[model samples]
Target: MKKLFIAAILFVSSSCIKVIDPESNYITGDQLASSADALAGMVRAIPVRLVNYQNDDAGIEQCSYHGMLSMLEMMTTDMVVSGYGGFNTTSAYTYGNLSARGSNRGIYPFYMYYGYIKAVNDVIGLIDSETDDTTLKHYLGIAKAYRALFYMQVGAIYEYKAPTDSRYTEYYVAPEHDLTELTVPIVTETTTGLDVKNNPRATFDTLYEFILSDLKNAETLLADYTPSSKVYPSLAVVYGLYARAYMEMASHKNATENYMQALNYAQLAITTSGCSFLTEDQWLDPKTGFNDMTSQNSWMLACSISEGNTDGQGGGFHHTMLFGTETTYSSYGWRVGRSLNRKTYEAISDNDFRKLSWLGPDFFATETHYDDEAGKWAYTLRSADDTYVGNYRLTSDPQWLRNRITVANGFLAMPWIYPGIKFRCYAGNYTSRYPGCATDLPIMRVEEMHFIKAEAQYHLKQEEEARSTLKEIMNHRITDSSYTCIASGENLLDEIMLQKRVEFWGEGINFFDAKRLGLGVDRGWQGIGYSRYQGTYDIDGIAFFWTIPFPTAEEDGNPALQGYNNPYMYNTAMFTYQSNAALSQYYGIPPSYGN
Candidate 1:
């Protein structure tokens, strides 16, 4: 696969060069360099490569950024899946398998980001930075910003920080086993296979420096370039990137300076983006909720998925997340359907509109029908007239409940509890047998910047300012006028994080936040939704399993990484677990509920 990828890169490079002799069908790099259209085409292709490129070697069509990585990241967090059929058997439930070098869980992300980085490098290598062509510079800025984004994501995933580190001591009990600090190898446009063979892992300081440098260049280059679509990075998006990078850096190093910078950039993004918070109507729209980028002004950057362009046969984000839609993986036998963590769901206040994202416990207070022949209990909701409607109202407005949580007929008999209805299908295409997975997934939004600003303020000792910022977003989310944040000190920080978690649930942002803040996984408690066979476990900060190991292929090919690979955590029991009987006794949910 690596060789094939390298060959494809060479082919793309050859095809893009200038065709000096039309008869010969050969082109020179110099000729391709002067064409602004060519540069733009290259820059545009980077997103497609990052989000949609399929790796056939992985034996799954879902080996792309949106299809696999996002879903996998969500699985590691508070997101819970019904343990019926094939869902419990997947690695998402058994996180120990994530450390296996041969596992696609590791390979998919390792290849996806590096593949994107190589493509971005191809574009960056062609542009002459001093050139007077504004068009070329615009493309260059976007490419650099994207490169920084990929590096930030990959670096966060692969780097291993010990729980014993001074930064994390307050949040975690140090694990019995400790590992060295390291990030992935640095690859560039000028790098050769020989260079790769000898390249060692980069230090976190070095990685952070490289990321900031790219964003700095991007910020300057994108100063006057106004983007026509949110798909491309603009000045605001660059500022958001700055905010994100500084926030991540502040997690461990130079907290005072980094958090202050994070706060400034986040405020800049919120003010300059020309985007506003999504009103209740926009957020909960049944047809276009979180599916259409143009439907709301909150989205700053997104990967636009069009019909027939994304994988619709159960590999895309919509296929896995939208249970309300028919023909999606979640709706078909509830095979891979996901639900909100009971603990997290219960944490949300009744007055908060975000709580409506998941079905309430009242939705499960319906009669059960036993299928004698199938030997399973089918859960169904009935109306006052005893007609099967599959509807349950949590609010006085029946139309509001009907619009967001409409379930397919096939799913009416399933026993999945508290399944999330936040991500809806495009155009309310719930009855169609064909998969309508054309939901534009958000990469960055102004809503996130508000949370970043609040967190930064809290870290910088501006407690009152932090409370105001938190209240600003909460006021927009909570319809109740009584809602106020009076918490101070550590409690104030917790409030800010809780709001952020609720706001970004299932969006793949929580895992990074959890890792950076050194929060442990505590899914074994009562009222949680983790499966029994998976066994509820409490892992300390820097869950070693969460730090993905370098793929076996990379280690074997790159000699320098053989001895220096991140620790193999599959054999190491880095977490403590309660017995199956204890878990079942406390949680009360059966393995295959109603089976």
Candidate 2:
């Protein structure tokens, strides 16, 4: 898909309100609905780009398809797998704090982000300005939900520390007293030549606070609202936002409550509102369902794009992160689309169709499903070798494309040529190369709700309820009556957490989950893989919380931000893994938190 690459995005205007259609010079009930561009530019959309910028969730599925490669950082796959040893990321990796709001090409999008925010504010202001009293209440609620959603994502990925407490001085972004005068922007020598903006990243506390305010107001507007808003935001979508926010806060109880809410809305959207999961056949076949996100199964999608459509591009991230496993490529070599870890691939049962989508050991011709007859299953196979081997696409010639062969046992298996499979659909009309390239980003889903409820019930000691919840979610995948469920104490929580990590494989939730649950990034002996971000440091040894080593301390330099840490940072000497202190309350920077 052709990406929209404009030079400079306008910041939120202080004096003039450039409403979505200040040009139309008129008002109508469909003002918000009429302009999809205006609605899309809201704060809700910025994080989609930001998450692409932040390579937090790489070893997962979504990235393999697209959006995983160079969302934020400029590094290549080799550089990411092996860190460039030094104080800073080795030259192998890309990204040098393009946080500042300006234009220089790769970083220009940052300004465009604020411009979108400005558009959202414009719509919001119009809603407030309208004297007609013909309220676009539902649309307004959706706008608020999206605004908070965008900010939440930016806060998590860009901000160094969580704003557990906005007043904490260590925070990267906070609303501070201008002191002697109106703010003229502050970089404080700490973040010098990088041209990266400081004082902009939102802290967890402030970010969540912003989210809560938006959500509360949204609830008020959404109380009598229906689910017939735009495809991007809805009641279920708002709850999804809440589910994510609470999960980040470590408020399992609240998280559970809201995730269930998300599921209910999802079901409502599916059965009544028109949305549902794609049939197995739609797996890697982008033409049928991958891009048609409004289907009931869609809990959340970045935005749908179809083959050959300009809107279909998976942004440029696919080319940057997902490097394939030493596979032979036509020309550009095998620079993009990496292979999935065998362990992760192996975890799936043969019956689990999704697992089959990725190329497995038994290599054959390049087809996976048979064409002579109809096929049905929950899993659809994604071609690692660009051919519809499973009789997926009815081709004119038999030998031209890989065709599935039926065995005596009556089971049809797609012949596989390569060892690795690429999940991303190639951009059809836009770019002939990556047809599996999908653009919509998933932030939440029903599967996530199931896990959220399970976690909540477990904490409440509602063992039966938790079991039933987990069963409800898992039953769809594994129906064996004897399949055991291991969930109790840490096991139950761990099971819940693991399920989330797996379900959200590429949706970008792992790193933060580890911090909220107090599970350090280090899996120790369990995780033998190396991290590019670790450089030569003891990444494998140290427990990685979201703790950004003090920027002042790091050679890259700390960028200034607005607010303080919601919960203050502690000195290095005072740092402790175990803390009875409420996370929202602690806010002092530890004197020795240097990496």
Residue 255 lDDT (model 2)? 52
Q: How close is every model to the real structure, measured as TM-score?
A: 0.83, 0.56
Alpha carbon deviation, residue 13, candidate 2 (Å)? 22
TM-score of 2: 0.56
lDDT of 2 by residue, 142-166 (tens): 6677667655544443344332322
In model 2, the runs with Cα more than 4 Å from the true position are 1-116, 129-139, 158-203, 222-230, 251-290, 294-296, 306-315, 318-334, 363-439, 479-482, 522-595
Q: Write the per-residue lDDT of candidate 1 for residues 186-229, one digit (tens) a residue.
A: 88767876999888888878888888899998998999999877
Q: What are the lDDT figures for the candidates, one per model? A: 0.65, 0.38
Please give the distance, in angstroms, between residue 569's alpha carbon in candidate 1 and its true position after superposition.
1.7
Using TM-score as the measure, the top candidate is 1
What's the C-alpha lDDT at position 515 in model 2? 38
Candidate 1, overall lDDT?
A: 0.65
Top lDDT prediction, candidate number: 1
Assess the local accuracy of residue 417 in candidate 1 as a C-alpha lDDT between 0 and 100.
47
